[model samples]
Target chain A: MVKQKGILYDSTMCVGCGECYSACKKQNKLPETNSDFLKDHLSANTYTVVEQHGDLYARKMCMHCAEPTCASVCPVKAFEKTKEGAVIYDAEKCIGCRYCMQACPHQIPRYEWSQVSPRVRKCVLCQNRISKGLPTACSEACPTGATICGDLDDLKIEAKKRLSEGSDKYYQHIYGLDEAGGGSVLILASVPFEKLGYTPNLPKQPMPQLTNRVMEKIPTVATVGGLFLGSMYWLTKRKNEIAREEKEAKFKRNEVK
Target chain B: MKNSNASKLSFWKIVAAVIMICGLYSSYIRFTKGLGASTHLSDSIPWGLWIGFDFLGVGLAAAGFTIAVMVHVFNIHKFEPIVRPAILTAYIGYTLVVLLLIIDLGRPQNFWHPLVMWNLHSVMFEITWCVICYSAILTLEFAPVVLEKYNLTAPIKILRKISIPVVILGVIFSTLHQSSFGSLYLIVPGRLYPLWYSTLLPVNFYISCIAAGLSMIIFESYLNARAFNLGLRLDILSGLAKIVLYVLIIGFLVRITDMIITGKTPFLFLPRTETYMFYAEVIVGTFIPVYLLSQAKYRKSRMWLYVISIFTLSGFVLNRINVAVTGLVASSKTSYFPSFDEISITMMLVVLGMWAFKLVSTKFPVFVELENLKEEKLPEDSREMILSE
Candidate 1:
């Protein structure tokens, strides 16, 4: 088995029931999180949430991307992409640098602030449950089946089938289908994703793709720079040597004369 | 190392002990209370005083690498006496950055993730690696003095033999990381206010660091003369001031070009704090310094040179903070100010760095002008051989 899988969520069908949020907390043993704005809006404990749109609802979670920026930017290999297409973080190794937070395009990674030793909190897509052949808590608890999980190919087909059936009920776009180098989680909606707080400006290319051209040149610059400096040193030393020798010869000639 | 006519033995020792105790207490709070509790940082302002000071400290300390390159690589023997002190200043500044980073990191323990995970694309990774490497190079380059202090003559001889290569390596590393610091903000194009954001951020950072670094050396020299009654060398300092003038002029030119190209010049006139800071940074930091250093008589004055350096240093500090926090916070909809604990911790770290520098310089013979053996009285034939080598 390739182990790569993901979820497709249709926001048009979401009823704002929030069964997915409650189910996720129970299944994952997550502590109770109050999403009230009165407190700090961003935190480490609540990995995912249900966002409200004008007439629709959307689920916000980690994208589990094929090209994960968080994984790429992490210096210590603290973030690992499992074969099952889940980007898992090892708390034991995380140094709390927050570089991952800066790199993620969707801004999915949340920091644990209330605790003494905070860890990065994010949706892992329940890899443990998936390994045991069970649906994630959100999908299982979804009353209207707004969320579905399966192979990426199968999810694409399911999304297409809904789009073609058209009836003007579903929008023609899938939110994460190709955004940020193809995230593991996909979305379908009647309204446009931007209206639901999804970032429409993210590039289709992977985050690192924009930076690789620059990173590749770092070593070359260092090497050539080193050589140029060394040569200058050699030349300057030679000039000083010549000047000193001339001064010595002049002193000796005067003495002999 | 103790001065014969110096003040009471108990006074300086007590001061050092008191500073050490305060620093230790601050460190304890930082470790036990967590960053949020100990720091004034919030989501709106991720970076604060520590980051601000790091830029200021490192930018001023750029004198270290710049002087090293001139003396060792460019073979400017005129700057030879100042090289070791400059390098030492850079070493301390870089070390402080690491200390500040530890306090800044939310999970200080996970700091190793960047090295182990190999995030090859992140600018932060490049910066982290470059800083670590450069610090090592600085340590190696400064080792000859330590070796000589301990009378380890063989290692000193070997270090002299490799000094050229080490200096070259140090220059390369410093350039990469200095620009990398600016590049760290490049990816945040959307978040960084338009006034501070520029495609030429890396280049701007490099040039400004060099200019600020030169000014710092002049300022430090002035301070030393006053504090220790060291002889003032007007010839070399004025020569350095000229270079500083040229760099400031170029830096101002670049800032203007960047603003025009990015069409951010219009924003400079807007009724906003960023606009105000933008002008303050450019006008006060660059333009004024350029004007001050341009005059021959002004450049010759130790007092005026120090004053201009202080202004230049302040401008650099404000520019960094404006970009990293002030400009950013205004847009993010939350006002972030460092709590008392945060400021205290930052001050404590700075005090520690100052004390460490004083201790090291007092004990070592770094700033002394040691004449070569060839220049000393010796047998003529042997002196000729030494001179040739």
Candidate 2:
């Protein structure tokens, strides 16, 4: 069986070396923008960034949720959660609605807005490398094991171990373990995840589930509601026809009398 | 008098021509230069004025089904006169919405992808289908008017036979999609502010749209009366206002009750921009119109009715804009303001719709009284007949 792969990011260990940033650009073959790389957030050209929160450094990218809202919300299924545990995108199928960007709980998806033929851009967990039995470039380039790539189950165990063993250094919580409903990526930080600019108030339940609850009712509503409306037309038409007949009959009886 | 009317028409024609020219140029820039260069949209705020206007268009177009239900299903013959124009307005409104969607989409050529691609979980997918199906339904419902103009008696007879079922389907489609538009926001509870977000968002949207739709019918009637020299049907206008009043009451109660039940009422008192906008939307859009229309004197008066309808329509516009734009403001890092080109294109669509409506009204029997319609046998070549006149 193909194991679901994921990344464990240890913010406490990251040295803010900018190695992962350079490695990611090289791996993705994206042109380096002239803008200050340290100051940049995720964009069409940049998928991952190492954010500095005071003294500590954190890596920010797609959370790649177990039940990704972007995949669920895409009308064309352009985004798919692969068995390899990466949420990959097919630009060919994309109609460029950019709804994926809107529906993402983490707001990680970026768009090539300036291009005449734009594509929704974001981290795919380096699916191509993972499929080829290789770790992501950022993970392989990290000197201090700050970013580790492995099976998601193993990463969860490792994340918990670090949190419990180094309680003095690491924050008690694993950031992505249950955020927006159990993302594939896990983060162990010394400071609160919110201090690292993480969205603080995500529900434990998956965002897609919120939409699905309402969307699942559509078929039932269409069927039952269609029947009700159809019957209403019949009933109202019948009532009007009977009323017309009765009026004519009464007029005929009066004429005969 | 004839020359004055002709001058007035020419003036409008010139204005529409200028707007359309500007719109075409903006659209050219939009298509060639791409979304980044043309509009003020960014990754954080992906949807902007175009989407907001799309919401407004759909909300205002709610009249198509509301009037259809009243006249055809409930057998409210008094509203029968306004039904054609209501359907026409809906058709024009929906056409503009589809046009805007195409313009907003990054891959406008791939607009047809939704037909074969099935993502039933997405509200947007559902909405796309509903709009398509509803537009076809609107076309069928409005076909009789076109048929009547062309003096196609046989098809008219057939259409009349199927009209009831057609109307029922129209209402069903409108209901599903109108509420589904609200459902579009339900996924964004994390992003949309608490003041505007609710699981009951769909229900609120459905109800408010009914009130707004009814008001639109009244507003259009007033416009039709002024533009076409048709006498104001005071009785019909007053009756519609009564229905709008009832809908407004129900909508207000539902919204307030939902807020209380969900324990989100405290958010209403928050000293936030969204909170103030929310108050303005509810008070000016809903409460004031309800109060004015509730009075018999205001309902009977032409000026009061016109002014109240405008207020109601503005309130509805504000509500939609709040949901689509304002509510999402605090969450995004980048603030969005629509560029000049964006506003121009929106204005162009409005002018285009108005021009088409005027043209059709003149060429067709859209404003004819239902009672008088039976007495007139129009020529087969009505276009030529009108031109000759």
All candidates: DockQ: 0.42, 0.58
The interface root-mean-square deviations, each candidate in sequence, come to 2.5, 3.6
Where does model 2 exceed 4 Å of error?
A238-257, B1-10, B370-389
Q: How accurate is candidate 1 locally (lDDT)?
A: 0.77
TM-score of chain B of 2: 0.93
lDDT of 2 by residue, A139-177 (tens): 999999999999899999999888889999987999999
Off-target runs (Cα >4 Å) in candidate 1 are A1-3, A35-42, A53-55, A157-173, A189-194, A246-257, B1-23, B107-117, B255-270, B370-389
Candidates' RMSD to native:
5.2, 5.0
DockQ for model 1 equals 0.42
DockQ of 2: 0.58
> Clashing residue pairs, candidate 2?
none
Per-residue lDDT, model 1, residue A226, is 80
Candidate 2's displacement at residue B9, Å, is: 4.3
| Top lDDT model | 2
TM-score of 2: 0.94
